[model samples]
Target: MRLTHSCIITNEVKKLSEFYEKVLQIKAETSGDEYAEFPTDCGILSIFSFSLQESLAKGSSLPGSNRNLILEFNVANVDDEYMRLEKLGVEFVKPLTTQPWGNRSFYFQDPDGNMLNFYTKVK
Candidate 1:
């Protein structure tokens, strides 16, 4: 089986969509105010409206309640991406640091407090 995409259920679709666009540096293809998608070479990252999701799968999920999952992005340069996000006023949960496994990365939070990591494999 292959992974296609991951969706974030959010109460503020537009707000979160805008935030992702700024962070990813790509425009989201939106479906009304209910859904938005940022397509990438790896897969599509999507945002779904809470109301719509509730209607489809009632009481299955909660908005802004993510604590254990960290959405990760593979970048060309962790340092460059860190500086760019820093200037955009993105709040960092952890500073850029090299992992013992040979990955250089940084952690930050989305508007809904969802943790996100951007990393580059170091040789």
Candidate 2:
């Protein structure tokens, strides 16, 4: 089975979309006033406004709701990406560090404090 998308619900679709635009270096397609989707290489990352969430049974509790799951992105060069993102004022939880598992990695947070990892495999 393939995972088509990983969706995030927030009250700020446009703001969050803009955040991803800078961080992911991709554009977002707005479905309406309340939703936008980024078509990434692996899968789509979507954001929905609270207006859309209100239409559902429960309201969205985004931003700081998730704690355990991390969103990871693989890059051709982790250090280069780190430098680029840092220049864009991205806040990192961890600086670039080579792991024992043969991966050079770093961690950071999105505008909503969504944990993210950018890494590259090293032999």
**What value does the lDDT take at residue 43 in candidate 2?**
94
The numbered model that scores best in lDDT is 1
- lDDT per residue for candidate 1 within 26-100, as digits (tens), equals 999998999999998889999999999989999998999999999899999899999999999998999999999
CA deviation > 4 Å runs, candidate 1? none
User: What's the CA error at residue 46 for candidate 1, in Å?
Assistant: 0.4
lDDT of each residue in 1-123, candidate 2, tens digit only: 999998787767788899999988888888877888988789998887766676684644554576787888999999899999999998889999999999999999877777899999999
**How many times do residue backbones clash in model 1?**
0
lDDT for position 46 in model 2: 87
Clashing residue pairs, backbone N/CA/C < 3 A, model 1: none
Q: Which ten residues in a row have the lowest lDDT in candidate 2?
A: 57-66
Error of 1 at 122 (Å): 0.7
State the TM-score for model 2: 0.92
